[model samples]
Target: RSGEAAHSGSSGELVRVQSGHGHFVHLVYDTTPAHVISELRPSVWVRADRPGIQFLVRVVFPHVANPRTGKPVTRLLAGSTYTQQGSWQQLRVDDLPKLVQAAVRPMRSQLGSHIDVREPYLDRLVLNLYAGAGTTRIAIDDLDLPSAVAVGNATEMAGRAAQKRGPAESPARRRVELAGNVLQVDGQPFFPRMVEYQGESLNFLKGLGFNVVRLSGAPSDALLEEAKRAEMWLVCPPPVLKDEPADDAQDRPMVFDARYEPVLAWHFGQGLTSRNLEAVRRWVEQVRRADEDAARPLVCDPADDLAQYCRTINFGGILMLHRYLLGTSFEMADFGTWLRTRPRLGLAGMPVWATIETQYSRELCEQISLLSSGRAPEPAASLEQLQLMVQAALAAGVRGLCFASRSPLDAQDPATRARAMMLALINIELHAIRSWIAVGNVTPEIKAANTEGVNPGITGGVLQAGHARLLLPLWTGTGAQYVPDQLAGNLITFVVPGAPEDNTVYEVTVGGLRSLDRKRSVGGMHVVDDEFGPTSLVLLTNGIAVSAMNSGLPGAGQRAAQIERDLTAYRLARVQEIDRQLARVA
Candidate 1:
């Protein structure tokens, strides 16, 4: 309102700011049959530099009051659309703050539950609004605005950034591939922790079929050694701190008070600071000089200030937008807008990985694939959807996809739940690999030589569909007494409790099951009823069931197995058509 122009409303004369090249759109709706609250959407274009692209959108909720009382009535406020930069230009030192100020005003008005904000940097603004039964209005401008990037502009920019860094040996020599798929770090077809120096885990990973391993946060020399020996690629982030940060349990800080936020840790800030760029650059160089693999490039999770870091360093792998772009949140569109600037971020075809913390990402990806293919969810991970997502990502020209962590499983009490989490990871990884292969472009062999299919367990059967998608809850102490025996196509559930901290192992026994006739010794299938406290379950896959039995719990053993067996049989029966085809053809 400070910068305004005169305008005439039906009631009287009112002052409204000149929208400039910005246009306004309004979305009006209500939660109830008769929505009483009202909202407006304003779109403004501001020229910005550096990160590039400019367009500020604000959803304004005005205070509608009674004229006689001369007091406020209903409060209205929600989210805002941030202003972006002009293609290839950085925001002027002066213009940056004005754009930021415009974006934050509405958010501040409805603080607390109604208004929520996340300010990653001085120039970045994020507003979230939870509106109840209300009316909303929206408007979008630039319906016919010219596209910003020229056909060959990004290619030229990428060339310039690369030339500035001079020449490097190669990115592969520094590579280290972890064993198996997600959580199974050790066991057959996968080694636990690979050390190129010791080279144990790397060798195991080579057999399992992983081309690349991420040493993002706090990787040890052992990890590096494994990579060297396995001949698999490694993607590591530059060390932000000498040691792990104080809040190492989770790098994400929790905000008890939404209105007033706290500062990020020193390491997070340093990773984005100009002072640290040189160190990061030097680290990359050192890795390259040490061995051929070092040049493979290091990946960085520039969580807060990506633009600041990318402007300086020649990062090998740049995580563009963490959870959002990966479909972890409801911000896929915003993520796409941001990703359009990847060529500007200075890493062209260098691997770009997706990271997300919640289940939303996988769920959302499934949704996207379904929408694209007009399919509805049957159950569990779908090969069809995975294929679609992988195809879409590859078409977008991304180098690779990297999931968030192995830690999520570690946090479990070596119980049933922990085992379940590990199995989930394995399921996810398997789906991912299968999806990648479906595309027929980016092969899993980038990390291995002969890749029929990637092994995701210590020793598990070659993955086939129609398996009951079971839940493996990382077992906490207070459950049943014995683990369930499993047969082919049975789902197993386990849990890791909370965070990936507990390093416990649970053993279960499966008696009446046989691996399919075509496979080797029901690969790595074991259920040992060891008296190791409460029986815990770990390293589970989609086709097995953990009978509900341990200690202080309810039903155990045979009964649970009966239920699981019934469920597995039902699922396989549904896939009988495919089974018949395989039998006849094979």
Candidate 2:
């Protein structure tokens, strides 16, 4: 919603607002800094048709910025107010300079009340009231701008202004950044084994091998503390105005909130849908002022691969891909086409990640019909199918991975642990070869072939990591096979061109990597052969990565005597912690 006011409209002086999700209404007097001779004492009568409607009076000056810190300056001078059960409540911010100064550094260049014309020359005062989910009718009277008047069609002007405005730019050199196509965290290559938090213990998730957790809404203090204790990163939502106020001594939105170290990135936007894309863009423009100097990158939600509308929407810098194909109605070639042209998307050296989960599955199109008929689903994806999907997303060239949201694959169902355990094991595998997987580039020179003729489904690709070549052979299963049957004992030969004969080759598998036997083809290509099953992972790396796996992985018969001695103690401590909880459901 634009807070830019139309000096006069057919609606006369009373500006009525109909606001909802992705919508806002406001009163504004857009003026040049020369005309800004202190009408900052903003007072307005706010009344909803219904009582108890929450309202806010934020004085927005879109073009305003602090001269000292180079941060955008927006005001919540008039704290928050409520419509008194259909009665009018006059909200006012008496000492505008005090509250505004308290919230931000003075934009007046020097101290005192003198306005500086040299720095960010604009004084467009906006009295904005945003909506929650549903629409609310708000009536405003007694527009109080001494130097100017409120625009009647402020909302209309805002929509247009937001359209003209490109997405906000975030400061560079974030905690998470990109080196080539690889994601670097604090100057180190980072492969985030991320899973959407689904009411699981933070310690449990950390122990299970997830380094990053996703939260749909703003996390609580306890949750942040727990994540810190668990030593995990978070993909979280931006803190809302409802939680923190401007008057609080210890709390400040722009500066203090920037210190949330556990937060890796902020996610916003309407996910895969485009109905509210414009409104979301507008909201981003206004909300970005609160996080002007914030460091972390912002990511959009459920980015639509079909429409790719999220590319047009502003999410700071980081944009995610949403082309999910391994599940129902998998299309290898069409999906691969998009992945291949990804680098040309002009991300400007920013790291790109993909949401590889059931949240954007084609099957949802049938059950929920969120997608078009062109994006169809037939056979369901099984566990083996999932394994191949992971291999494809990484091998096809995605930097990092965020696991499914509200997905059974991401869920840790106490009753059903097989799928969760398998995913955890896959995370373990991804972490092992992350050295190459994070920064490797896909090349057509590397190839894999089955001994028993060419298996159309079981194929592989080579990753050209610096000085090291990694090969991932996936049995993706061709034809109408949704979940293909296991093909065991068949030998697959992988050939990597232009590698030395004495390359230290290793095979990365679930939980660890093992040294593999390498042979040279008659044509002088590096070749490694291994027998694998349907769900088996065949990842071979040549001469770069070190083997971290112990050779002491015991067989089933010898495993009983080698179980961890602290298993029982750990279990007892866990049970005690559960019992000590405030609300024990049991």
User: RMSD to native for every prediction?
Assistant: 26.0, 24.0
Best by lDDT: 2
Lowest lDDT sum, 10 consecutive residues, model 2, at: 554-563
**What is the per-residue lDDT of model 2 for residues 286-344, given as tens digits with 9 covering 90 to 100?**
44666555445666654334234334433445666665564446554334445556545
lDDT (0-100) at residue 466 of candidate 2?
65
lDDT (C-alpha, whole model) for all candidates: 0.29, 0.52
**1-586: candidate 1 lDDT, tens digit per residue:** 1112112222211122221111122222221111111221222222222111223222222232222122222222222222332221121122332444444553354322333232212111221110111121111122111221222332333344344334452221111222212111111122121111112254433432234454434345556444445455554443332222355656532222211111010112222445566665555454434323222333555644455555433433334335433323333223322443554555444334443222234556567678868443322322222222322333333434543333332232323232222233233233323322222222111111012333211111111112211112111111111111121122231221221222223333221222211111222222322121111223222322222122101111222333334335545765785677679879
Candidate 2 achieves a global lDDT of: 0.52
Candidate 1: worst-modelled 10 consecutive residues by lDDT:
258-267
**Shift in Å, residue 240, candidate 2:** 3.6
- Pick the TM-score winner: 2
